[model samples]
Target: MELSQNKRVADMNYFELIAWLGIGSSHPGGFPATKQNLAVLQILPDEYVLDAGCGSGLTACYLAKTIGCKVMGIDINSQMIEKARTRAEKEGVSHLVEFNIANVYDLPFPDNKFDIVIGESITVFLDKVKVYREFFRVLKPEGRIADLEMALLKELPVNLRHQMEDCFGAGTNPLSFEEWHNCLAEAGFQDVEIKNPQALKDNGNIVMNELKKDWVLIKDLTNKIKRQPTLLPRLQKNAGFMKRNRSYFGFGLIYGRKPTPVKLGFKDWVRQVIFRKKTNSSK
Candidate 1:
């Protein structure tokens, strides 16, 4: 199908947007808590961190309060950034964290400023190539990026795949392993580690135990959407193309670092998921 205008987070409610955006992140460990989500990515108390596509900044704020470290969070939507900042301040982490309204491709910082960068299911919403290059430019050498984003295992059943393909359109990006590697390599990240953070892990059952109610709701909704199919996409406000490919998509995850002294698991593949970053320099 043809790609046109990009989709916005407001295409749906904040919570629902986050839900759809975080594919394959079954939160094995409960939503944010279930997967330990960003929490699993430990932080150093004195290091400076950048959080790209910080959404509500829950992870950013938590990073600051938990580590007492300096963190700068940025996102394209001004309103979301504002809400994130307010929450940070209310939680008393504002002293160590700052939120900004900006796009991932045009970060406002000097090169090599952040010790670590994170995108908690945020990269799926950005232009992967340009954003990865930007991250390479702004991060401190050897800095790591962690994210829980949707990855591709393989194509789902055609009907499901096509339905998803239509509903998401260009908004949905599915990448093979090789494609992901080339992109990261071209962007200058070495020792890249791209594997299923939850691969074959039965943690989904544990997660389902918690979100069971939501699971039932989503399943019922899923079946309901399949029947009409167009209904959910329309309700989600997806345009024509997105609605056309609603079911043609699936998800998984990725993580990597800037040129670091580590093992190289190099390979050629198409990539879909991404993790974004920010720095100490204020916008």
Candidate 2:
């Protein structure tokens, strides 16, 4: 690997990755009520928590230190994982937390393994359906899933969707609000519920305000996407609508749980196989 000029490489995947979350709500439709929302899910000592896509691993360290629980953090970015591990050591929670490099699409664990699974703003990086299915596989009975995702209130305009590539830098996978519910339901999650960021105005403002400096970058990217004939129309139409009414009908912070094994059908097996990817790796 080569050295980076910055603390992290400006690669699409790691660009502003840790800084955004570590600094506070860098995600679009950012964390709604942050700690309060996370508290509702509840994490206690002795629990085995999985922090998927744990970017810089700060959250995992927090879980380990604060809750006195063992936290396993996984991400596809090895550099991110390495940084997380070093941070854990610096914070002196290295023993309670383990950081690893792994793909969400291919989790290296068995059925019914985790007590809690928390994914914060990492959903955009994955195939959602596949991740949810895999989420089910590794979760223990009644295991909780807390997700911080950006959900569109309506279909994104072509312009916005086209610029998604630029905004994310890394390839991003997006799903509408309905798509999130359907996928969670399809994954055998029970008592699924969702909360929108707009519903929590103060938090939304905090997120947008923290991102003021980013406005220039966002504006530039939008302008670039707007000039492209193939993309301008949708951004003008679909994505524009969300941006305009984001204060009202923007993004959502959702949480769900995997229920105990339910009666299965032939089709169910197929669904499981679709999301399940066998991997031979370890913490």
Worst-scoring 10-residue span by lDDT in model 1: 268-277
Q: Per-residue CA lDDT of candidate 2, range 1-283, in tens?
A: 2234343223413234333222234455343344555577678897899988786675677677778899999877666676687778888898899988788888999989999898877777667778888988999989988777766656656675556655454456556777777888887888888754443233323323443433222343444344433333432333444454564334565667787767779998887776564332321
lDDT leader: 2
Model 1's alpha-carbon lDDT is 0.58
Best candidate (score: TM-score): 2
Q: Which stretches of candidate 1 lie over 4 Å from their true place?
A: 1-40, 156-162, 199-253, 260-283
Worst 10 residues of 2 by lDDT: 1-10
* Model 1 residue 229 CA deviation in Å: 19
After TM-score superposition, the amount by which residue 42's alpha carbon in candidate 2 deviates from its true location, in angstroms, is 1.4
